[model samples]
Target: MSPPRVLIVDDNLMNLELVSFLLQAADIDVSAASNADAALRAIAEVAPDLILMDIQLPDIDGLTLTRQIKADPRTRATPVVALTAYAMKGDEARMLEAGCDGYIAKPIDVTSFASRVKAYLARRAASSSS
Candidate 1:
């Protein structure tokens, strides 16, 4: 089977690079976008299996975009994970409410980041198969 494709949507250049580098090192396909518009375009072009979204986007917020994705029949089944610095109380719940399938806090632990992403993909595959 082919490697899973992931789209990381974040306004920060460094964050995008770090996540992409880490995932790519694990032999995953990584695509990135700096803002919501680019992210939407990337989504259409990449047809990513998963999306890692940053809440504090320059354009539309990630949660709103997630809502849009969930509302769309074509993209609704693809898992969307919130990857943000918002670790406050109820933040994860709020993200989940907005349609995120998972949540990962920001300033990610580099050592375990790849494994965590792979776990999400594995879980998604398992769930879809069953």
Candidate 2:
């Protein structure tokens, strides 16, 4: 079987590179976009198995993008995990409300990030197989 594909959407180059590197090390295929528009296009072309999206983007809000992706029948079933620096109260709840399947905070721990992502992906795979 082919490695799972992950779409990462972040405007910050450093964050994007860090997460992309970590995920890639885990043996997953990654496609990145620096903005929401490009992200949407990448999603359409790649049809990734999962998406790790930043809540703050240059053009559209991450929550808005998540909602749009979830609303579309073509991408609705794809899993999305929200990645944000927002540590404010209720931020997790807000991300959940936006339709993300999971959430990860920014300033990610490179060591554990891949494991966390793997856990989610494994869970998703098991659920889908069931």
Candidate 3:
């Protein structure tokens, strides 16, 4: 099987590049969008196995984007994990409520980021099968 394709959406150039580097090193297919408009476009162009979304974006926030992605029939089944530095009370629940499949707090644990991404991909595969 081909490696799972993932989309990483964030406004920070450094964060975006770092995440891309991490995923690519793990042999995962990775794509990125720096803002909501670009992200929506990318989603329409090719459906990703999972999305790593930064909650605080320059345009629409990640939560709103997650809801929009979930609402679209073509992309509704795609899993989204909010990748954010906003580690606050109730953040995870809020992201879930916004239609995120999972949450990964940032600054991401560099040592475990790849493993976490792998875990989410595994979950997506399992869930899609059954």
What overall lDDT goes with each candidate model? 0.94, 0.91, 0.92
Model 2: per-residue Cα lDDT over 49-102, one tens digit each = 899999999999999999999999999988999998896889988888989998
Number of the predicted model whose lDDT against the real structure is largest = 1
In model 1, which regions exceed 4 Å deviation?
none
lDDT of 1 by residue, 1-130 (tens): 8999999999999999999999999999999998889988999999998999999998899999999989999999999999989989999899999999988998899999999999999988998799
Per-residue lDDT for 1-130 in model 3, tens only?
Answer: 8888999999999998999999999999998999999999988886889999999999889999999999999999999999977779988889999999888988888899999999999999999899
Where is model 2 more than 4 Å wrong at Cα?
Answer: none
lDDT (Cα, 0-100) at 40 in candidate 2: 88
**TM-score: which candidate is best?**
1
The per-residue C-alpha lDDT of model 3 at residue 26 equals 96
RMSD of each: 0.7, 0.9, 0.8
Q: Candidate order by lDDT, highest to lowest? A: 1, 3, 2
- lDDT (C-alpha) at residue 1 in model 3: 83
Residue 75, candidate 2: alpha-carbon lDDT: 94
Candidate 2 pairs with clashing backbones: none
Work out candidate 2's RMSD over C-alphas: 0.9
